[model samples]
Target: MAGSDIKQSLRKLDFPLCARDALYQIEKLCTRPGKQMELQIDLMSEFVFGEIERRRKRNVPAAIQELQLIEVQSDFFQSPGGIPAVRNALFLSLYPAGSPRYKILGNLVSLAITIHNKAVLNAAGIWMQQLGSTSQESVGLARHILNDYFVLTSKSVDRLQQLPILTPHFTANLLTAIGEVYKDKNPPTEVLRLIGEWINDNPSLLLTSLMDNPALPTGGIPMTPITPIAGLFRWCILSPVRTAAEGSTQNEDEQKLYSKIQHLLMDSVLRLKSSGSNKHAISAQHLAATTRALTLVLQSFSNIEPTSRDLAMERLAQAVSSAMSANCIYGNKQELLLLLQSLSYQHFLIEWTLQTYSTKAV
Candidate 1:
């Protein structure tokens, strides 16, 4: 329907729901073919933005998210004796973080960024952090926020830190995604700084990553989400960090930040190799991640650091060699040999060890 026609139909309906149903109908319209939507997109977008902004008159980051704060849809959360606000009802009922209607928020966030709207940018971290939001919701918002942050100059780097505390699963995925996004090139100081901060905040973050879930009431094992650790390794070791971010003020020593990140990655590797208990043991899938990270770490160190190169090599070799023993119990010898053989091209050591280990296992 035409914009005017849609409005006329809405006018014919009852009070609060009339406004809501109008927005809902627009939400449905958005999912149709893009070419057809060109006519109505602007009209619908303007209506949603204008109506919400006018009703809330939000002037600050906190105020911008006032609508989201009302998690439930009810009269108690609305204005007294005024036209009942539809935002709470719309957000809670009509649209969830996963539904097609959720795209509206993504659109609004993009437009806000294009115009340099600082308050809305900060508000994203807050509203997206609402507890009980599943990994799907957090990842959706985080991808948009991080992707946008990539285009920002270093002067606005502080905005990266303002992202509220995310769940561990979300954080893990974010770290891995960062690696892929920058896979083809060197990461700048701004990106490195963000990675370092995340590593510092999460203790034993990588070491415990691949373990299983806790036992259930029926006595099942306690578990953590099982995901490929290769991405984490790539995020940490495959890429080099620049001495400084492009166009940065050169105020802080970014190379030092890189060192901190390397140290954290190395420590996590050590934890994985040294801890012999069931809690630290890896399953068959984790071997791929471990091999890739180990290969990249040794390779990356040869290029990135000089002073600790020999010592890191020594400690890592002994620890990893011990982890690879038949009695190690993390993964069986057959799996390890096969995994190493597949990764033989990663390093000369892998090729040589795979040949020798294959002989022994056979």
Candidate 2:
């Protein structure tokens, strides 16, 4: 069929059917090898973009479904030049939040991450930034995307680094997402290595940015949100001291790497504890998140050597205790107590295990 005929048909039909047909045609065109079909692909993309815009407000749900199909099912977005236009179309259609359409948008975001195409990532990043501005729901979804999909490897980092605009807020959110992933029991070691390298490269800048938010409305006192910092420490503590092989000592290089990460984590925890002195700056939510993160960090020490684990537990305990004492004005006392109780129980188990092992050895 001719391009004009297809465009005419797209206008006549509803969004869902139009999108399906448009995607099918685009896919068929894309499958043909070489640039011979480039013009056809561009034309189909424009047609899809235009049709979606035309019907966006009137039938947003349908438009979103179409976008999802395009993102997941077609390679139209595989073209670098076409990415921005398609991305803008999706972003613009994502208005009037809290609609069922958001679920589809969330899936599209996931697909973009999975695709890992540079152009798509840029688009997804921009869309995330925009979503973050809208509401808590959108922000929550954004964090979910980060936690579930964003891989903290060199390539992913490079994509984020090369984004045309990596605003401070976006960077903070990105770090927070990484933190959530680190909260997992067995977050990838590559993620740890990447973050450790990043911390080492610019030790103060990222942490300072994370910790030094402007004063909240009530006072000029600076209150840093503890979630991201907590995630980092949780990840650090969870980092393996040795490989899976039992009784195998780490080589010199591995030992040095472990020591460096341990030091970085200790320094970060100390910084967080010191920040607690600004009690007026901290809030109930901040304190709760901080406590929760610290609890997780403390729990992660179960797999480490006796000396290193003891030192980590001590520093974490001191940090948590100091923060709680200074910021007693905020946080749920009961919740904090429970977390501490859990940590204490875990610590006891670890100690008991060590003592039992020592006695047996003797």
Best by TM-score: 2
Error of 1 at 134 (Å): 14
Tens digits of per-residue lDDT for model 1 on 209-293?
Answer: 3442311223223223432233333333333321111222223464467457656655555455445543333343444444445
Model 2, which residues run further than 4 Å from truth?
Answer: 1-157, 161-166, 203-227, 238-312, 321-362
lDDT of each residue in 1-362, candidate 2, tens digit only: 66667667767765446655665565444444441355454444444443335555454565565665556433544554443443333343333345444555555555555555544444443444344422354455555554444443334544433222333333444555555544444345444555556556644523443444431223223323333444554444433332321334445655455457556644654555556543332233433454465455445545545655454444445434433444423444445444445456546543443333322221
Each candidate structure's TM-score, on Cα atoms with residue i matched to residue i, is: 0.43, 0.44
lDDT (Cα, 0-100) at 214 in candidate 1: 19
Clashing pairs in 2: none
Candidate 2 least-lDDT 10 residues: 214-223
Model 1: lowest-lDDT 10 consecutive positions: 241-250
For each candidate, what is the lDDT?
Answer: 0.43, 0.46
